[model samples]
Target: MNATDRTPADLLRSALAADPARPLVTFYDDATGERVELSVATFANWVAKTANLLQGDLAAEPGDRLALLLPAHWQSAVWLLACSSVGVVAEVQGDPAAADLVVSGPGTLEAARACRGERVALALRPLGGRFPQAPEGFADYAVEVPSQGDRFAPFAPVDPDAPALAVDGVELTSAQLVARAREDAAALGLAAGSRLLTGRTYGSWEGLSTGLFAPLAAGGSVVLCRHLGQLGEEGLAKRVESERVTNSAV
Candidate 1:
């Protein structure tokens, strides 16, 4: 971990500075036969746009709680970093009733209605396509995000000691989250430029650490796979070789 990095956003910025063209996230959905790869610059651009949406369009203030009801998809990772950039506390699969804002996938719109502040829905379509029709009372993230500014600057400086993420009933401050991520990267034997493949969900700390944060903190890249069990043995081996994966947490 960089000595100057104190938060997930800082780690991402460091990575972008080191090699913006390097692959940052390579995602696959074995269930859908979908594959997408994002370089560090591309990923940061997405994060910046999403953060602008959260901060400007949604009128999100620092310390606001955002319930993130998405799976371990690439967009989910974008939202995670966007929340950090805007100083919003991201609650993975958190209860919408108590959230100041809710970002849900197609499968979770009904539950997302409990949020009184604001609601956004993602289609999770290939190439980040828009939903054919927007869900009632919710802004379509794909439709709205495209017009947002490509650069993001938070209204106020984020406090590293403030709450940043909550998952599985555990809350972690930004600094603590980065610290844990670095520890996990070391434990996983990750290094700069290492490629880590993971088939873990984002419902637990371990899964989040391995699937996203650890690799980011270690200056490595991730091959995030969903429904990987469907790939079977031979297909999985082919993916490992094709993606040039170095470490795995499947």
Candidate 2:
């Protein structure tokens, strides 16, 4: 990885340029029996659209804090990069009341409602479907994001040195985040083109580092597992063989 890489979004762009067809994030929910794979181009497209939703629709500006009350699902990952694209501060599982925007998953209605800022709710349904009905005081993310522009351009340039992520009382700038991810990639044994499988229940730096950032920074890919407890050892071994997973940290 280059020393100039500033944000997680930059890593995605690099991967898209290197191999657009290569799988980037392969998501699985053991309990729900759902699997979705995204190539570099496809993942970038989602990030672009979601970035537009955050900047254009929600008017989220640089330095604004977005409380992400979501698990390690693929959509949650998308939102994280979206925040980076638009230069908004992404705070994982942060206090909703203090945030400028709030994004919540299926069962976080109470916490979502506690946020007075702009709110978005994800159904986490198979195929990323919309909520059956709009959650009060919240916009349905699935319905809103796709209609936004396919390409995202921030209103103003994002300073790489500005705060980008906060979790568990720790804060890091975009530049710092990318630098740390590079360090983590080495520690996790991720190599270019490697396929790493990991669990998706990570709450802070450790989870984000190995599950998303490490592979991305190393020009590799991730197979993120949710509800992993439901998969037996034999089933996991079969999946590793079928998916050709090069490594695992689960």
Candidate 3:
């Protein structure tokens, strides 16, 4: 918990600084939506801007809650980074009982009976085309967040000892896990430009550590698959054959 250790959110600045031009995340919506990708620099700027929006503009004191309704898309990833950077209490829609805010998709409202607190809906799509207006009490998350952009000021520094994200049903402290990941990457003897293929489910602690952070720590590339099967066996076989992935952690 010393001042020296850097939290996961803190690491974002360094990651973006190191490889500002690299593509970070991509999303394909419902086959009709075009996939959008963002570079590291753009991603960082978006996060910083969002953090500023949440903190300075929103007048959100630390521990003030926000419900994030980002789906499994690039925007969700951006929101995740922004939440981490700004120190807002962000709970995505999962456990309604424990969450204070609910980020819902186009017409889907988080069930109030399941929720234990005040709820708001955040839509990821355009407004008019989307279905079902906000229920009686819930607010629109989309409209609420952008206002935060101008007012949010950056935090002084991140204490790695503080909670960065929830992992394996536990609140993971940034210092310990990141240290282990850095060390583990070194152990794997990975070099720069290594192409690392990752399984789809990276929401778990192990997945985040191995798939996202480890390869990045080693200055390697990560091949993201929504599912192991998405890349056909032949495709994966050829990739493995050509890329010469030295080792796989999964």
lDDT of each: 0.95, 0.89, 0.54
When 2 and 3 are scored with lDDT, the better candidate is 2
TM-score of each: 0.99, 0.98, 0.67
The TM-score obtained by model 2 is 0.98
Q: Tell me the alpha-carbon RMSD of every candidate.
A: 0.6, 1.0, 5.1
lDDT of 3 by residue, 1-250 (tens): 1123355465555666567786654333423434455566766666666677555545444444455543444455555566666655555444655654444555446454355555555555532133256555665555555444433345655445655555446454566656765776677665565656555354565565555556555555454434355556786677567645555554
lDDT of 2 by residue, 1-250 (tens): 5557788888877888889999989999999899999998898999999999999889899999999999988888899899999999999999999999999997887987878889999999988999899888899999998788888888998899999999778899999999998898888788999899998565878888777888999999999999887999999999999889998888
Residue 9 deviation, candidate 2, in Å? 1.4
Backbone clash count, each prediction separately: 0, 0, 8
Ordering by lDDT: 1, 2, 3
C-alpha displacement of 59 in model 1, angstroms? 0.7
Q: How does candidate 3 score on lDDT? A: 0.54
Clashing pairs in 1: none
Error of 1 at 105 (Å): 0.3
lDDT of 1 by residue, 1-250 (tens): 4787988999999998899999999999999999999999999999999999999989998899999999999999999999999999999999999999999999999999999989999999989999999999999999999999989889999999999999999999999999999999999999999999999999999999988999999999999999999999999999999999999998
